[model samples]
Target: MPKKDQGLGPSAETPLPGDDTVVCGVVRHLGGDYLLAKCMDGVDRKVRIPGKLRKRVWINEGDIILVGLWDFSPDKGEVVYKYGRNEINKLIEKGFLSKEFINALSEYL
Candidate 1:
């Protein structure tokens, strides 16, 4: 049988917001359905798992995730995506994240 396509091709990356408002964060704590994430920008944001992804995705503390900052609430955001091991390595290679940050996450796991 032919393999079924899983949607993402070469350009599976979700289009980034032009303003650079989205940033990487580490999940610090889980508050039931919400999360307290410490962003790379040095601020802790209350990150919410949107309804669409809530049931499908399972996030845990210390996992690396992408967050889209809220315009009205500077210290709050939505959890956009979670980075897998390979994706994390690629981000580090691309200079999107620092080696120190990756080291930090590893220590927690």
Candidate 2:
């Protein structure tokens, strides 16, 4: 059978479609103790990248990043692959995200 399309990139600070299996979306909203994000699989999942990610990287909203995949019940997505500041910067420079919103998964390179 042919493989299903992964869909278009996150244009306009949209959540990533959970499919890459390895990649995960960046922080779309951060308020509560944990952060809310749309995973690469397109699943909006909660992540824990506060202490480390926050301090290390200036994680603004809408950042397409690689993340570690974690499973715990029917609802839950944890951050496993945390990119550093430099990497995050590269993502920004790539311009896959919105400059204004600065929140998106990917864009046509």
For each candidate, what is the lDDT?
Answer: 0.70, 0.50
What would the per-residue lDDT of candidate 1 be over residues 78-105, giving only the tens digit for each residue?
8877777777777777767777876665
lDDT score of residue 56 within candidate 2: 40
On TM-score, the leading prediction is 1
Candidates' RMSD to native: 4.3, 13.0
Clash pairs for candidate 1: none
Superposition error at 97 for model 2 (Å): 13
TM-score, every prediction: 0.75, 0.45
> What CA RMSD would candidate 2 show?
13.0
Q: What TM-score does candidate 2 get on C-alpha atoms?
A: 0.45
How high is the lDDT of residue 39 in model 2? 52
lDDT of 1: 0.70
lDDT of 2: 0.50
RMSD of 1: 4.3
